[model samples]
Target: MNPSEDQIYVIIFSTLFLGGLMSTFVVAMVFIHRQRQAQNKQKLDQIKSEHEKTLLNIENEIQQDTLTHVGRELHDNIGQLLSLAKLYLGSSKPEKQQEGKETINQVISEVRALSKNLNLDWVESLTIEEFIEQQLQKIESTGFCKTTFEHSIELGELPKDQKLVLIRVIQEILNNAMKHASPEEIKVKIWKDGATRTIQIKDNGKGFDTSIESSGSGMYNLKKRMETIGGDVSITSSIGNGTLIHLLLPN
Candidate 1:
């Protein structure tokens, strides 16, 4: 070939090679930019979620503090003043004042109970029946479903950790029933079989097949929690039949 043709071939090859290199570099740059943007977006979302959780926790703490203060005020100050009034009012007679005093006593009892229930940490002060009643009372107060509690299990020396976990498990179960099962009535029955304490919760709702997969993580988490607490959960349900959840606590 002539020198001119050889030079032309070399220039064409160089130009094509240079173009390919530039195209590759541009594509790589775009990919890196997208990767960095994705990473930054993930970080921002994580930060925002953490911030919201922190705020929620702080709000809960403040509410707990307010409940504690109110409970103390009711039991100490209002209860004392009621007693003083009972004495003054009874200074005249018994029949007329007894009714008033007894009413005041009932109020005091309710206030104390309310105070105890306002904070879950103080649930240790209640018996198993009382704790269950408190939870049911909360549910009933919501007016979502009619709840009936039958507790035959006597209160013994139960561990505080177990008490707390049991409360959480009960709450979770009730939450599942309310959210997923759409129950009109929920019945909670507690009984003891020697060393085994049982909590049975039955709901008249559209039960799902337990053998099949479910989108609800609440049931899975409930079972996980019971296992974590050295307890076991037995759930029975069909498509149309109502659901029954039993928790056996080996204490």
Candidate 2:
């Protein structure tokens, strides 16, 4: 009853073929699993990037909105009070100038109030162009650095958040120029090119090497702020050539 040679050969061939097919199936499964893992990682990375961008945008929106409210309060409330004080001073009788010294006292109080709210409210309410002009006027009043501001666009309609961010960025840049650039003249230009708004600040001062490490928290914060709003900042300067700060934001 022993099996013939042909039957034994057939049985062996069948076993070998099945074994090879099982091995191929296992290898194919491993390859598919690896591919799936790679795809999942890529998707996770994309989601993380998108989430970061969304968070930054939200931060910018909140900051701008808060500044706008503060700006309005300064212009409508404090600014009016100052104007009223000036009017009272103008109408005071000459005979009672000494006795009407209360008018002067009131004016001084108004001035102090205005100064207290200048940076917070006045800046928040002004359009980008108006804010820049006011900043230049302030710098000129100091008589330390001559400032020039140029604008090509009517920026009355710019988003409040964007205006606030731009104002802060420019303020930081100008402060750096005045403190470090030692420049006699500082020029700031704001304009729109197609769909993009640009701000350029240049100073004819003693420049520094950009390659060296800088301990400027203002500049770093400005960069972070701009990034939150999907804006960009660039600096160009050398040991004696002067310094230039450029900011670009989408309209």
Candidate 3:
């Protein structure tokens, strides 16, 4: 028997209603997905902004420190050399004149070396190894402590931002050791294994317990800074055994 008109109308109406519900569900899903994508993008942009700001602040601090160092060298070292050269040149002897000429040449060389540090562009061309050696030499020259550096392995090239961050971090650690630890000797070592690079700075000075958060090593701030560069900072110390800090980085 054939279907009646009333039955056919009911069947068509039911089909239309189900199709409408499906379309509404799809639209809702699309709307929710787009909203989530927007939120994620905003979060990412904020994080990028914060990272850049931190990097800029660090660069400024490094520049300021460099300027301070240059000022001290000019006053304490170069000034003395110039005074001696003037004295020698004023003497009435040929030997004295020759000595003055040599001293003036030395002064010129020293000035040239200092001029390089006045700008941060030199940092781009310097490797981590070279920077460490320079810092150690400076520390030793101050007569505050003896310093040594050992490079057991070479690290691959690093991004410029990462390199700058590392330099600042190392400088902070050394400064802290000298100011707080009062160590007679400071040592820095670098090594690498597979994809991991490590820098270890050790001081044979009074140490603090790592368990305490207020140990004054500024480890908390250092750790946070390392996180910004995808690195890790760890410390080992006791009350009198001295302090050892390890900085870890990925290839």
Candidate 4:
């Protein structure tokens, strides 16, 4: 009942050939998988490098802006106070001399407040809500516009780097409102919506059409910046109406 010798040899040859083919296929699959893995790793590394570069630029811009603000305060507020003090101190009257002493004390206090802003180390400890409130106060102090801030609860926190980016972006938005919008009211709100933390800035200023693309790259840059931090920026506006900007971050 056994097969012939020739039949057995044919069977053995076919079996060996099929096994070789299977091994070759497996080796090809492994090579392809490894190639894809390498490609993915390279892409991730490039993204990491880009994110770090963006963060560095944000840090530099923040520092420069702080310096500029400090310089202005020194020249406008402190310098004027010093001049007034000098005039008062030069008077022979006791009341005028006493006024000069009080003015000098005021100047000292103002200088100390400005000194804290010279460095960015304070940003590390400051929360996002606090920053927004401080900016609003500054705007109100200018008498250029009335400011309002509303928050339902404490917004979630972000890492220091992300926090800095958000801070700069918000500052730019507020500045744009003052420079271009000239709105009577600038209102900011913060709240949590589901899995997102939202910061909304509303200004009753002359708004522009959203349909038409802007010649400037400001909005584009803002969107890209939010993307870098896994967040998003949304702006809604119409001519003669007002502008509303929403800065959204994931919880």
lDDT of 3 by residue, 145-230 (tens): 99999999876577888888899999999988888789999999999877788999999999988888875547887887788888
CA RMSD per model (angstroms): 11.0, 8.4, 4.0, 3.4
Give the runs in model 3 whose Cα sits over 4 Å from its true position.
Answer: 1-29, 141-148, 215-217
Residue 87's lDDT in candidate 4: 98
Question: How many backbone clashes does every candidate have?
Answer: 0, 0, 0, 0
- In model 1, what is the error at residue 180, expressed in angstroms? 1.6
lDDT (Cα, tens digit) per residue for candidate 2, span 1-251: 35798899889999999999999999999999999999999998986686476555545554565467557756876566566656655665765554346656765675566455534455556677777787789788999788888888776666655656676677667778888888999998878888887888899999988888687565667677677567888888999989988898865
Cα-based TM-score, every candidate: 0.52, 0.59, 0.80, 0.83
How would you encode candidate 1's per-residue C-alpha lDDT over 137-195 as one tens digit per residue? 87899998899998776757677656666766786688788888888899999898878
Q: Write the per-residue lDDT of candidate 4 for residues 158-199, one digit (tens) a residue.
A: 788789889989998999899889899999998887778889
* Superior candidate under TM-score, 3 versus 4: 4
Residue range with the least summed lDDT across 10 consecutive positions in model 2: 114-123
Q: For candidate 4, what is the TM-score?
A: 0.83
Clashing pairs in 1: none
Which runs in model 4 stand beyond 4 Å of their true positions? 1-21, 89-98
Give residue 134's lDDT in candidate 2 (0 to 100): 79
Among these predictions, the greatest lDDT belongs to 4
